[model samples]
Target chain A: MQGIILSNETNALTLAELPKPTLKPGQCLVKLSAAALNRRDYWISVGKYPGIQPEVVLGSDGCGVVVDGPDTWKGKTVLINPNVNWGASEQHQSSDYSVLGMPTQGTLAEYIAVDEDRLMQKPVHLSDEEGAALPLAGLTAFRATFVKAKVTAGKKVLVTGVGGGVSQMAAVMAIAAGAEVYVTSSSEDKLNKARKLGATAGFNYQGAEWVKEAKSVGGFDAIVDSAGGNALNDYLKLIKPGGKIVHYGSTTGKPQELDLFRLFWSQASIIGSTMGSDREFEQMVAFVEEHQIRPAIDGVYALSSGVEAIERMADSSQFGKTVIRMEA
Target chain B: MQGIILSNETNALTLAELPKPTLKPGQCLVKLSAAALNRRDYWISVGKYPGIQPEVVLGSDGCGVVVDGPDTWKGKTVLINPNVNWGASEQHQSSDYSVLGMPTQGTLAEYIAVDEDRLMQKPVHLSDEEGAALPLAGLTAFRATFVKAKVTAGKKVLVTGVGGGVSQMAAVMAIAAGAEVYVTSSSEDKLNKARKLGATAGFNYQGAEWVKEAKSVGGFDAIVDSAGGNALNDYLKLIKPGGKIVHYGSTTGKPQELDLFRLFWSQASIIGSTMGSDREFEQMVAFVEEHQIRPAIDGVYALSSGVEAIERMADSSQFGKTVIRMEA
Candidate 1:
């Protein structure tokens, strides 16, 4: 089997010949047809993610066929939930919970042995690549937008840093849910692309007084943000009283000088979210299917070119999910 | 008529002979029996609060007899709900909502004309001073503990800066609701006072590794905080997965270097809250009546000594509410 591995010595994702994963009890051996890259993969490759085990297969999103174990799922096409051991509570994951990649083996390989519960029937409307893209980023976006921020019809929603996989997915979902969607991106091209995806307007975060511009069009009911820098202060200014700011990532850094006065007086909430529970994964797939959402694909590469696919996440130019096709 | 006034030129709370308030339609002229000092009053006196109006009476909490208004009743004893024009949404106050003080004339007077809807029958078991202390701080604590943090039976709750009016009220409410309460304060005397109020344990925030000590007793299910400084980072480390951190004030200023990683991974929520809605104020009053909970009064002063009452908030030595008795 061929897969991408990140070793302690190299600290980089590399394609290598490796033995196929062995299935444990109640686990299904999935022969992956497609796998997608998330910022999580990029972080692991750069040695920034916690609990990075040396030489672990790296991918949190995949679509494939169950090749062995669990007779009920053996021959079915499936999408992996990626959120392992999500525990019992819907409010949050259990302490033992970990994402698919990291300590446990992941997709982005010939095969992955995942717990039977982590397998869901791939949304029939999606292609293998789109199905792969829908798991990790889709679950994250669903939880951040619906569960956390509670984005809904007639909502004025702002999705920030729209080039990333989760942000793009969140924008798309918010638009499909009848929100008046707005977006921010560093690149004009990405902003334009987001506008074409049904966003009412877009702004460049690098531009002067963008927060002021965002507020001029009536303040937002919810703002989904990934960049956790000083922009949060701006979000506080842009949000209407009682609006929510849901954050799933902090790529830039810590937000300095957070004006808590505005926060408490306005009664705003700053919610922190990550990859969602298995139940949320099912709901996300159902939502994508119901809305006929086809995840935008930036580029797909063969397993041998997996390193380049992960690198595409490093540059801010990519507008959507970067994928690796195991059978290409 | 007499009242405490804040003027631009003086910039100090001064006891002055004031004109008796004239009642308008749907308004009542309440002859106050007691008034309470809150941190909000202290902030406004120091010119820190927004929308400062010169010569406006400076107070929010009051218990009084309806000396004038409506055919319904003229001599009824009542507690005032200081939240004015709270608008429609129960989630947050309307844009036009204002506390009883500041831009609107407040409760720190012998006579106050308040809207009819702001009046509720005083709890039968409470003294005038205790009823006066129950409005602003009681509503705030009810919102932070039951509404926002959702503290419940068998849960472990933490109240930060327990000496403040809201924090003390929140600790009392959480304990009455069967939660195992903990507290943090700079003063050991305040901590001991909190334990007397049914807190299971108390920690001094000024002590070294207080967060570690807090976690050793099992992490908290929710934390009600008024001090919003770097202690937020400590709260993140001390909270259980899915726990909430509800803040009502930011006395110590911005939290430098908030760790976004731990927050998201733990799936915690940081909620900002202020004085609650009128509905919550009603619920709080009901809860206090049902539990026969008496607010702790630090000291009672005559109306002429009202300046000293405001000063008591600045020193942070008082264990509970500092009240001013109108007839003392």
Candidate 2:
């Protein structure tokens, strides 16, 4: 079988011939049609992610066909749930929980073995590329927006760093849920693109008076953020009383100069979230199907050119998910 | 009438002669027997609090007997709810919300005019001094513990800076609610006092590696904190997955070096709260009555010596609430 593996010998991710995985009880063989890149994959490739194991397949998002499993799952087109060992608690993941692709062998392969329960029927409205994009980023955005922030209709929501996969998904989902969605981006092009996707407005964060401008209009009921640093203080200023700031990633990697006075006085909440649980994954897929949501695709690469897809992600210029086709 | 007023002439708080408050429709005149000091009062005295209006009375917590009101309560013993104009929302206070001290006239006067709804029956278990100590600190602690953190039986709770009024009240309330409570303090004397109040354990935060020591025992399901500088990073490390860090004050007045990675992966929430809403104040008083909980009073000072009491609070050495008796 052909797979994209983080090669121990070369210290790089490369296409290599690997043995086909044998199915255990309750396990199914998935012939992956497409896979997608996330910031998690980029971090792992750069050796910045924790618990990186060599020789493991390197994708958490995939759309595939189940070749061997119980009668209910056999021959079904599916999107894989990347969350593994989610355990019992809906409040948080268990101690043993791990995402797919690093420590556990993942889905960037021609043939991958997965538990039957990890497979969900691919949304009929989506192509294989879009289906692949919908698992990890979709679930993450869904949980952060819906569960953590409790974003609903008539609420105003802000999605920061709108070019990223999860951030874009959050903006799209909030808009789909009838929210007044706003976005921020350093790139004017990304801001324009977000506006075309039904964002009520876009703020160019590079502007000197962006926070002031944002506050001038009105405060947001919820702010979905990935960049967490001095910018968080600005969020404290812009969030309404009793608003929620839900952060899934801290791309800036610095301490926050949060204004505690504003926070307590306004009774704001700063919540931290990551990838969602299995139940959230199901809800995300259902939402995508019901809304007929099409994921924004950046560029697609063939299996042989998978390295180029990761390079595009590393430069941080891609506006959406970069995908890899299994067939050349 | 005698009152402790923030005198505009001297730019200081002093005992002065003032006209007794007259009742408005739906208002009651309460003859205050005792008033308690909070950090808010100290901040206003030093011109550190926002919206400091000179000539205003400078206390929020008070216990008194209603001298004149409607037929419902003309001669009832009561503890005044310092949370005024709390408005509608249970999630957060309204924009018009203000604690009783600052811009509005407050409880330090010999007579206070309050809305009928702002009065709660003083618990039979408490004296005038203890009832005065219970309103502001008790409401803030109740909101942080039961409302924000959702603490319950078998939960492990940590109360930081346990010597302060609100922190001590939080420790007591969590203990009364059947949580296994731990406390942190730089003073061994304060830690011993907290343990006597039913904390399961105490950590001397002055000791090097205090965070490590706290983590060695186990992570806390909820941490009630007031000091929100770099110590917040320590709380992130000590919090269990899905834990809540509820902060009501930030006496340190510094930015936080929070661990974003730990925060997101653990799925923790950092909630900010000030004085609770009217409903929460009512609930707090009810909880006190149900538990027969008496607030810990540090010292009783005569109203003429209120300046000395403020100085005691300014030094931050008081082990519990400092009360001022009206009779000298």
Candidate 3:
């Protein structure tokens, strides 16, 4: 089987021949049709992520055909739930819980053997690449927007870092939920693309007094942010009294200062969400299916061109999910 | 009627004679027996609070006797709910909602005109001073502990800055709810007092590597914190993954930095809560009655000595709620 493997020696991701994965009881072997890249993959390649295992298969999101084990799912098309071993509680993941891409065998390969419970039927409305794109980013957006921020009809929501996969998905989800969705981005092209994807408005955060401009429009009922840094103060300023700031990533690194006076006095909350639970993954897929939403694909690369796809993502040049076509 | 007043001319709280308050329909005239001081009162005295009105009455929590209006009973002892005009949302307060003190004529006076809905029967177990001590701090603690942090039996709860009214009440509430409550305080005396009140253990936060010491005991499932600053990072370190950090006050001021990586990866939440709703106040009162909890009172000052009581609170010298006795 051909897959992209991160080498321990050079710390570079290379297309290499890998042995086929074996399935155990309660596990199904997936013949991956397509896999998607996340920022985590880039971090792992550069040795910045925690628990970096040498020669680990990289990629957390994928859509595939069931090739073996679990007779009921043997021929079904499914999306992999990247998270594994989420413990008993629904409120959060357990200490043992882990995302599939790092220490475990991930989906950026020809085949993956995952727990049978970790597979959901791929939304028939989406293509293999689109289905692959929907797991990690989709789950994260769903939890941040719906579960954490509770975006609803008549609510005004802001999706920050609109060019990223999670932010794009969050905007789409909020829009589908009947929220008036706003977006922020550094690039005009990305902002325009987001507007075309049903955002009510877009702002360039690089602009002078972007926070003031956003505030002039109106306070947001909820803000979905991936970049956590000094900009958090801006979020505190832009959110309405009693509004929520749901953060899933800290791309710009830890926040430098949080005005606690403003936070408590306004009754604003900062909710930290990560990858969704298996239950949330199901709900996310159902939401995508109910809305008939197709994930935006930036580009697809053949398994041989995986390095270029990763590089594009590393540069943050892509506006949507960058995918790898496993069958190619 | 004799009361303490913050003068527009002198910018000082002085004993003054004020006209007796008249009651309107749906309102009752209470002959105030006692009132308590909160940090807000000190802020108001220094003219630092928002919406400071000239010559405003500056007491929020009080216990009084119904002297007029409503035939149900003219002699019932009741504790005033300092929050008023809380519009129809359980999630957050309305724009019109304001604390009873400041702009509104407050309970520092010998008599007060209040809405009938804002009074709860004084707990039979409490004296007027104790009852007065319970309303503001009790409501804030109840909302922060139960509503936001959801501290439950067998849960490990940490109450930060336990010398203050809100934190002390939070520690007591968590303990009453069967949680293993721990406390952090800068003063050893305050920590000892908190332990006497039912905290399982208390840590002197002034000690070197206090975070390390607290972490050695165990990770807390919930932390009720009022001192938000560099200590917030320590709270993050001490809390279990998926724990709640309910913040009500920023006495130490806004946090300088937050490790978003630790926050999100741990799936922790920073929930902002202030004075609770009318419904929450009622619930808090009921909980107090059910648990037979007596609010800790530092000392009672006569109405003529109101300035001294305010001074004591301002200096942060009192270990519990400072009260002003109206009958004196």
Candidate 4:
């Protein structure tokens, strides 16, 4: 089987032939159809992420066909959960819990083995590419916007960095939940694209008065943000009293200043959310199916061209998920 | 009428003869028996607090006799809810919300004119001094622990800076709610006092390995903290996965380095809580009544000795609330 392996020595990702995986009890062998790239994958390849294990297959989001699993899962089209060893509690993941594509093998291969419970039937309306895109970014956005922020109908929501996969999904999920969704992007083109995707409005964050512009739209009930830095202070100004800012990633690094006075005085909350729990993943899939939502695909690459896909993600110009077709 | 007034010119607090306050419609006049000092009062005296108004009687927590009011309240013993103009929202206070002892005249006066709705019957079990100590700190602690952290039976709660009024109240509230409460304080005497107040254990934060010592007891399910600085990162390490760190004050100033990686990966939450809503104040009073909890009073000062009390609070040596007896 051919898989994308992250090299520890050279700090590069390359396609290599790997032995077929043996499935133990409670595990299933999956023939992957497609997989998607996340910013973590690019970081891992460049040796910028923590726990960078060399020789590990790289991909946390994938869609595949189950060839050997429980009677119920045989021949089913499923999406991988990516997260493993979540343990018993729902409040948080266990200390040893890990996402796929790190120390353990991942779905960036023609054949991969995963726990049976980690497989869920792909939403019937989505294609394999879209299904692969839904796991990592979708679950993250779902948990951050809905679970952490508790976004609901008539509530105003803001998604920062709208061109990113997770931010786009956050906007989509909030909109599908009947929220008035707004987005912020550095590029006007991306902002327009977000507006076309059902956002109530869009702001160019590069503008000197973007915070004022957002405030004019009315203080957001919830702000879904990935960029965490000095920008976090601006969020305090744009948030309605008692509103929440749900952060899943800190791409801009640690926040330099969090206005403690504004935080407590306005009764605002800063919620840190990551990938969804198993239950939340199920809810996300159900929501996508019920709404017939298709994750936007920015570009697709053949299996042998995985390097190109990773490079594109590194460029940070893609507006949506970049996918790799396993058999192309 | 005699009142402790914050001077506009010198930023000094001095006892002065003032005219008796006339009650307006929907207002009640209270003859304050006692009032408690918060750190905010000291900050205001030094011109460190925002919106400090001269001639404002500076005391947010008071217990007194309702001398003039509607048919039901003429002779009742009541504790004034220092928070005024809380508006209608349970989620957050309105724009007009102001704490007593600020721009608005407060309870340091021999007589205070307050909205009738701000008065709640004092718990029969408490003396004037104890009841006076309960309003600000008790309300802040109540909202932080029960409302924000949702502390429940058998849960582990940590209250930092345990000697302070809010921290002490948090420890008591969590204990009364059936939680296993721990406390951190620099002074051994303060820690011992907290343990006597029902903390399961106490840690001396002055020690180099305090985080390790706290971990030996167990990971905290919730931490009520006022010190927000580099120590906040240590809290993330001490908290159980999915736990919350509820902050009401930033006594140590803004946090320099917030570990965003640990925050999201562990799904930990940093919640900002402040003075409770009117509904929350009622709930806090009800909780206190049910638990028969008495707020700890450190020392008593006469109304004429208000300047001394402020100095004592500034020294940060008191183990609990320092109160002023209005009639003295």
Candidate 5:
């Protein structure tokens, strides 16, 4: 089996032949067909985020056919949920679950072992690349918007840094949930891509007053701040009274000038969310299936080109999911 | 009618004679029995928090009887739900809406005009003092814990700064919801008070490593942080992967050096929530009524001593809800 390995700090990844993983009792051995890249991956690879262990395979989002598993799961085509609480843990032990590519070995391999419970059946209509793309980014977006922000019909929501996978997913998903989606990106090209994806409005965020441009569409009920630095202060001012500014990333860093006074007085909230729960993931799947929402595929590469996919995430030049194909 | 008015910053509140509020169609005028005070009122009184218009009424929590309204609502005993949007500018605005303080005028007055819809039937057993204390702190805790953090049975939760209004409610409510509640207070006296409210564990947070103290209680599935500052950075380390840290206030100014890297890799969340919605308030009232959760009353002050209540909140020595009594 071949997988991408992060062997040390501040270095490019190495493609290495690795022993195929052995399945634990409740674990499934998956023959992966595709995997997706995320910003977290780039961060982990450089050792900036300390959770990833040396020699760990670094991919959290992947689609595969279950080669061996519980009799109930064998032969099923699925996407690994990637949130594995290694055994020594019970239900939601908080410390037990390690995200793929971080503490635990991830996808980006010929075969990987994962808990059978963390595998969800991939929709037949979705390509392997699409299935791989949907888990980490899709779940993060769903939880950030619907679960954390509780965005609903007619609410004006701003998805910042829309070129990123999660923001794009949130924009598409929020629109499907009946919210009026507005997107901001540094590039006009990506802004147009978001506009074509049913965003009610799109703006190039490089403008001095992009926040004002976003507000002219309508006062935002909530902001999904994928851009978690400077835009956050302005994003705080963009929401209507008692509105929320939900975050899943701190792309900018822990911001200065949190303005606790404004947060308390305006009755506005700064909610932070991560990936969706298994329950929320099911809901997202049902939503997309029911609404027939198509995840945008930027481009697919062979698993050998995982570095290229990661470089795309690093540059923030891609419009949507960048997938690593495992097989035909 | 008489209302407690802040003539200017730090000025002693004077009970001044004023015109009784006249109800608009679909509005109910509340005749005060008792009103509650929050840190918000204290902040508004000092003008440190701004948004305070001079001579404005200074209460956001209270219970009273409806003296004038449509036939259905008149004569009803109700608790006002604080957290209202000003409808005057947003026509087709609700007349029954009330946010006893904040952008809309508040409830510390002898009378407050509110939309009939913002009124909830007072719990049959709660005294005016207790009922008056239930709106802001209670609803804020409700929305932060159950709604935002999604805490449930068997989850380990931390309530930091327990002597304050919201944490008290959070400890009591989290206990009632079957979570393992641990409280943090610099005062041993307050920790004992928290124990009475069903906290499984209590710690004098004075110089203790809260992350270690919380770890002894099985680590937190969620942390309700009203006490922010450098301690929050420590609380950040205490949460399990996928756990939530719901922040409502920072008596400690926003601390620098928040480890965003720990947050992203662990898939942990920091949720910010303020007060609740009309629906959330309704749910809170139902929970209180069903559980018979008695809001703890710290001390009762006469309407003339409204300034003193603000002083008490500033002293940080008092525990539980502070109430201002009107002529019986």
Candidate 6:
């Protein structure tokens, strides 16, 4: 099986041939078609992922065909939910929920083993790459906006840094759910794409008063913050009293400085969202099937070029998910 | 009407002669019988409340008989549910919301006028001083445990700084709800009292291995953090995967460093809980009255000694709520 491995050496990626994993009871062998990269993958390469082990497979989101599994789950195209619980009856019900690509060897190889409990059937209409993109980034956005922030219809929402996969997913999903959406990006080109993706308004984050501009749409009912630090603090102030800010990742290294008084005074909440549960992942796949919400595939590369994908993600200038087809 | 005013510019608890307040529609004028002191009242006196007017009355929890008001609220005996609506509604339509002593005139005076919406009917069996002690601190603990943390039967919980009002309430309620409760405090006396309050175990905060002590009881399912600073970070590390730390006050101030990667890896949450909502306050009153959970009162001071009450609250050598009785 072909895969990418991160060594102890910084900023290095190695292409390696690994032996295919054998399946255990309650486990299924997935014939990989496509896998998507997450920001954590890059950080893992640099030892920024806490307590990570070396010489492991480096991708998390993927779509695969169940080549071998429990009879109930065999021979179907599926999306493997990344959160893994090894030694537990249920995936989410376990004591330690490790995501693929972090502590567990992920889905980067041509053949991978995963628990049946965390596998969701992929929609037949979408390509493998699109399905691959939906698990981590899509579910992170889905949970943060809908489940955590409760971005119901008729609410105003802000999705910062709309160029990234999570932010773009947030903008599109919030719009589909009847929320009025706004987007911000440093590049006009990225803002233009956000407008095309149904953002009701778009702004340049580089502007001195983009916060003021975002608030001109009126105080947001919710803000999904993949872009953190001052951007998050500004969103906190821009939200209406009792509104919420759903945070997933802090791409910026800046520490979050929030006024504790403002938090209680407005009855507001700062909710942290990581990834969706197995059940939520299933629900997200169902939504993608019903709404035909395709994962925006900004670029597709072969397995050998995974480093290029990570570099694009680090640049923070990518428009959407970057998927790597596992075939040569 | 005679009221206590502090000599400090914000409180000025010297005796003052003023006309009794006239109530408007949806408003009630309560003749103060007693009020409870929270540590926040001291913050109010030092001109530290974030957005309050000077010479403000400084109490958040009190109980009294309504002297006069619009027909809708006249002649009612009530506990002032001091969580005031900084907005028109509370988080989730419940409506007891406020910055409390920080942003509004409080309940310390001999008489106070309040909107009809913020008062809860006094439970028939409790004294006014007991009822007064049930609002700010009681509701804060209730919501932090029940509403925000969703503590349930069979869960393991850790309540930090036991014997203070919220801490004691959390311990007692956890016991009533069938949870395994652990208490951490600097005082062995307070720790013993917590055991009497039904905590399964109590650990001294000074124990360098309190984290190990917490884990020995099975890593906590949820932690209520009234104790802050590096303590919060240590408590956070003790949370089991997918567990939570419900934070309300940060007595130790900001500057506690956090490892965000640990939070994400363990799926641990730091949820901020202020006081419970208006409806939550009413619900808490019913729960306590039914369960016969009389809040532990350490000492009662005549309203004339409010300054001394504040001093006692700031001293931290005492346990339970300190009440200031105005009538008897």
Among the numbered candidates, top DockQ falls to 1
Report each candidate's C-alpha RMSD, comma-separated, in the order given. Answer: 1.5, 1.3, 2.0, 1.5, 5.5, 3.9
**lDDT, model 6, position B157:** 91
Candidate maximizing lDDT: 2
Residue B292, candidate 4: C-alpha displacement in angstroms: 1.5
Candidate topping TM-score: 2
Candidate 2, DockQ to 2 decimals? 0.76
Assess every candidate by TM-score.
0.97, 0.98, 0.95, 0.97, 0.76, 0.86
Q: Residue A133: error of model 6 in Å?
A: 3.0
User: lDDT by residue for model 2 over A184-272, one digit each (tens)?
Assistant: 99999999999999999999999999998899879999999988877888899999998999989998885556678788888899999
A230-300, model 4: which lDDT tens digit per residue? 88889999999889988888988988767777887778888888887888888989999998888888998
Clash count of each predicted structure: 0, 0, 0, 0, 5, 9
lDDT of 4: 0.89
**Candidate 5 colliding pairs, count:** 5
Q: Model 6, range A66-143, lDDT digits (tens) per residue?
A: 999898888899888887753443212365666787566788778888888878888888899999988888888877
Q: Who is ahead in TM-score, 2 or 5?
A: 2
Off by over 4 Å in 3: none
Per candidate, native contacts kept equal 0.73, 0.79, 0.71, 0.71, 0.28, 0.10
lDDT of 3 by residue, A1-328 (tens): 9878888777688877889998788999999999999999888877788888877788899999998987899999999998888878777899888898878989889999999999999989999999999999999999999988989998999999898888899999999999999999999999999999999899999999888889988899999998999999999999998899988999898877899888887888998898878899899999999999878888888988887778767668778899899875
Deviation in angstroms for B3 in model 2?
1.4
Query: In candidate 1, what are the lDDT values of residues A61-123, reduced to their tens digit?
Result: 999999899789989999999888888899888878888887888898999998898889998
For candidate 6, give fnat to 2 decimals: 0.10
Q: Which ten residues in a row have the lowest lDDT in candidate 5 chain B?
A: B86-95
lDDT of 1 at A248: 86
lDDT of 5 by residue, A175-288 (tens): 998998888888888988888888988878778877777767657888897667656668767877667787788888876655554554455666656666677777777777
Candidate 5 docking category?
A: incorrect
Off by over 4 Å in 2: none
Per-model CA lDDT versus the true structure: 0.89, 0.90, 0.88, 0.89, 0.79, 0.77
List, residue by residue over B1-328, the lDDT tens digit for candidate 5. 7787777555656667778888788999888889999888777766676455677777898788988888788888889888676344321114344446755667887889988888899998799889998988899899888987888999999888898888899889999999988988888889998897889888777764656766766668899987666776687678876678888887887655566656654556666666767678899999999889988888998887777777668878767899888874
